[model samples]
Target: MKPMQSPLQHTQGGTSSGHRAWSALIGPIGLAMAVGVAYFLGARLSLALLTKPDGVAVFWPAAGIASGTLIALGPRARLPVVLGVVAATIVANILGDRNFAAGVVFALCNAGEALLVAGLIQRTFGREFRLESLRSVVG
Candidate 1:
């Protein structure tokens, strides 16, 4: 008689377990990489077009990108989102001709800013937050 397998079990045997694990990892990895790339590009664009003689940007859209990503992903995905923000911020600052120390500091500050914004929004409106109402946006 053939061995009976649970419905939850994969029919592909040993290799399928590894494949499943790898695929699970791929989702987070891909999200991180996409966020990193987006952050880097946004920062670069803002620095190029909006930076002044004092090295401050008139508008920094990267912050919005990071904060929006954090809020969209929620607390469960905070690790990967922050990681991507940190990596991208560091690289963007370095490529923008800042020193290594400055890059690291800027990266930390940017990530912290994103976290703070996301935290405040979550606290105010809960996890299922939507900016559909005026109170949600202003308050």
Candidate 2:
């Protein structure tokens, strides 16, 4: 006689146990919002200094780093948060002054901030996406 198989065995595994929507959108959206707020605040604070050509040197990078680091700290959201920070920083720079030089500065600062924040999280909170090691046992 042939062995019986369950109907579910033929399917592509069971339904996902993790979040479907938050994993898709909330994290990235939150990061974008935070970056926007930071950028505007930075721009406003630097307005007086930005009156001179050299004063454009001050705000954008600081804003990008601060916002990016904060966003990366959310749970189960490392990937989206980091990407959103970069995207928002670039968008903010482009829309604020529409210049390549300023855009590059924002990019570098955002990248640095993401790296630093990710490293700290990995070291302190323990990595959530690591493979588990198998243990040996005697019967």
Candidate 3:
């Protein structure tokens, strides 16, 4: 004496093992893509802005991108995001012809800066924070 379930209902609410497996695979793949693209763009821009022999860029967009990614992905994905950033950093340095040791140090600094920025922004503005507001600009 039970009612039958609709296909839509089953697809939407059922705990199918297939759905779980897809999500598990897709999430990491998606995250890796996002990180790789962001890191590549940021590193390229930073290299373009390099104005001195010391290898420092006039403006490091990677820092901002890393921070923004961390914010968007929330805290659960920090390690992976940072790892992506570090990999990107090493790649950038190698392409720019810098030494391996220098690349590692620079990557560490960039990741640390991104982590600090993300933590501060999350703590100050909660999860609803946005940079489009004047308040966010001022704060």
- Which candidate gets the maximum lDDT versus the true structure? 1
| Residue runs of model 1 more than 4 Å from their true location after superposition | 1-20
Alpha carbon deviation, residue 91, candidate 3 (Å): 0.7
lDDT of each: 0.81, 0.51, 0.77
Superior by lDDT: candidate 1 or candidate 3: 1
Q: Write the per-residue lDDT of candidate 1 for residues 78-105, one digit (tens) a residue.
A: 7777888899989988888898899899
Alpha-carbon lDDT of model 1: 0.81
Clashing pairs in 3: none
- Deviation of model 2 at 79, angstroms: 2.8
Residue-pair clashes per candidate, as listed?
Answer: 0, 0, 0
Name the TM-score of candidate 2. 0.45
Score every model by TM-score. Answer: 0.82, 0.45, 0.77
TM-score of 1: 0.82
lDDT of 3 by residue, 97-122 (tens): 88899888988998898899889988
The whole-model C-alpha lDDT of candidate 3 against the native structure comes to 0.77
